[model samples]
Target: MLGSAILERRLELEVSQEKLAEMASVHRNYVGKVERGEQNLTIETLVRFAVTFKCKPSELLAEAGL
Candidate 1:
């Protein structure tokens, strides 16, 4: 799932949810919801997260099995 993948990558990077949110230019609550599978993400947001994590968006999607 996207949430799991995002959470895993964030942890792998040793960053806090708040830091990830800042890096991705998203709200902290949004990041939390995202990691909890409580939100649907737009492509722009996905790209932001990928950029923050230094990974390709396709890789993130692949991680999510999408």
Candidate 2:
């Protein structure tokens, strides 16, 4: 799922939720919610996450097995 991929990629990059959020211009709590699968993010937010993670959106989708 998307949550799992976010967790895996974040950990793989040794990035904290706060750091990711800062990079994505979102709240740390928002990042946490996304990672916990409690948030249904907008496309803009998803793109921000992809940019912050330095990966393509399709790559993220693939990693999430979507």
The candidate that wins on lDDT is 1
Candidate 1 stretches with Cα past 4 Å from truth are none
Model 1, range 1-66, lDDT digits (tens) per residue?
Answer: 899999999999999999999989999789899989999999999999999989999999999999
Clashing pairs in 2: none
Lowest-lDDT window of 10 residues in candidate 2? 40-49
TM-score of each: 0.96, 0.90
Give the Cα error of residue 30 in candidate 2, in Å. Answer: 0.6
Please, what is the whole-model Cα lDDT of each candidate in the order they appear?
0.94, 0.86
- What RMSD, rounded to one decimal, does every model reach? 0.6, 0.9
lDDT of 2 by residue, 1-66 (tens): 798898888898898999888989998798889989999888788888898789988888899888
Q: Find the candidate with the highest TM-score and give its number.
A: 1
